[model samples]
Target chain A: DAGVTQSPTHLIKTRGQQVTLRCSPKSGHDTVSWYQQALGQGPQFIFQYYEEEERQRGNFPDRFSGHQFPNYSSELNVNALLLGDSALYLCASSLATGQGWFLGEQFFGPGTRLTVL
Target chain B: AQRVTQPEKLLSVFKGAPVELKCNYSYSGSPELFWYVQYSRQRLQLLLRHISRESIKGFTADLNKGETSFHLKKPFAQEEDSAMYYCALSPLGSGGSNYKLTFGKGTLLTVNP
Candidate 1:
């Protein structure tokens, strides 16, 4: 398995523009999560998707949205991007198992570097 | 609100010396803590999780619930061990959708030769 894979390793956008990042989960994985890591900071949870539905969401604004396809691939779409939106966007995938202790064990991708001007 | 804090932004130590990366958390309920590491030009990966009670690459972290800390430590540091380390926490059970992780800012460890 290639673990998790993200598209467009780098991106550039200006204010009010939109962007969409894609992610393909690891083989047999059923859940996908997105995170944003700003400069000099750790990854912050953006949202999580399971069964093609958003299962959990973080404190991000409404401008940030996501979708999960039947194949477990996911897309993160940002509308009206702001300068602060510049950061590394990460996608993580894991099995949605009933095992609570291991649920958060996610495998991350290389991450897409988004630069907003 | 849940939060993880890594007290040091950067830590430097010589080879064969001991090193410790401090982490403290603030969460109301039982949390699953984990240590993640990122090497240069590599993706972030899990080093260890509290529940497993295992060590990776000679690094071990003991979760102190009383102090709400999961500090990663190593007795003998090596140049290969130099990387950015992060401490993360997840709520034990939140309707089976608690996979979200709260992470610390991270500590950049530099093991000098």
Candidate 2:
């Protein structure tokens, strides 16, 4: 099923530069979420997209944004990146069951390591 | 506001010993809790969730509402069990959306031989 797949296994960008990370959700899944995991820390939710609209967001600023395509693929864009933005970006996909937000298991990708210099 | 807390960052145990990773949370409403594990060089995966009351890989977690805690435990630890564990909570979302998860910093479990 290819599960979930993310792009550019690794990336290097300078401060103030912008970066976009892509994710393809598992087949048949309708929702995609983005998270940021700093070293030695659990992933922090950036936002979740469903039905081509952002369903929810975390405390992160607008500098971090995302989009979900009709095919369920997603992208996370960061503007004017700071060194603090350097971290492992993870993409997760789940089915948007009518009952609850996270009713089923979320399949995560291998993650893209972003290093802002 | 919702938050998940894992009290320990690193927990080391000998093979075959009992292991317990503590987690606590703060939320006004009911919470759907889950335990996620990440092995070396591998993507994160769900170990189990409190709602299902099912055990995975010999690991189990019980949610104690009175204590506001959901701790993951295993009676016999194995070296393969060494990994980072995260506690997550799913709260209700506004405007007909489900809230994004709130995750703890995580606990690193090392089952040494």
lDDT of each: 0.93, 0.90
**Residue runs of model 2 more than 4 Å from their true location after superposition:** A99-103, B92-99
A93, model 1: CA deviation in Å?
0.2
- lDDT value, residue A1 of candidate 1: 82
Residue A23 error, candidate 1, Å: 0.2
A17-90: candidate 1 lDDT, tens digit per residue: 99999999999898899999999999999999988999889999999999999999999999999999999999
Which residue pairs of candidate 2 clash? none
User: Every model's DockQ, to 2 decimals?
Assistant: 0.56, 0.53
Query: Per-prediction TM-score, please?
Result: 0.96, 0.94
lDDT of 1 by residue, B1-113 (tens): 99999999999999999999999999998898999999999999999988889989999999899998999999999999999999998888653436679999999999999
Native-to-model Cα distance after best TM-score fit, residue A16 in candidate 2, in Å: 0.9
Looking at candidate 2, what is the lDDT of residue A111? Answer: 96
lDDT of candidate model 2 versus the reference: 0.90
Q: Ten consecutive residues with minimal summed lDDT in candidate 1 chain A?
A: A96-105
> Cα RMSD to native, each candidate?
1.7, 2.1
| DockQ of structure 1 | 0.56
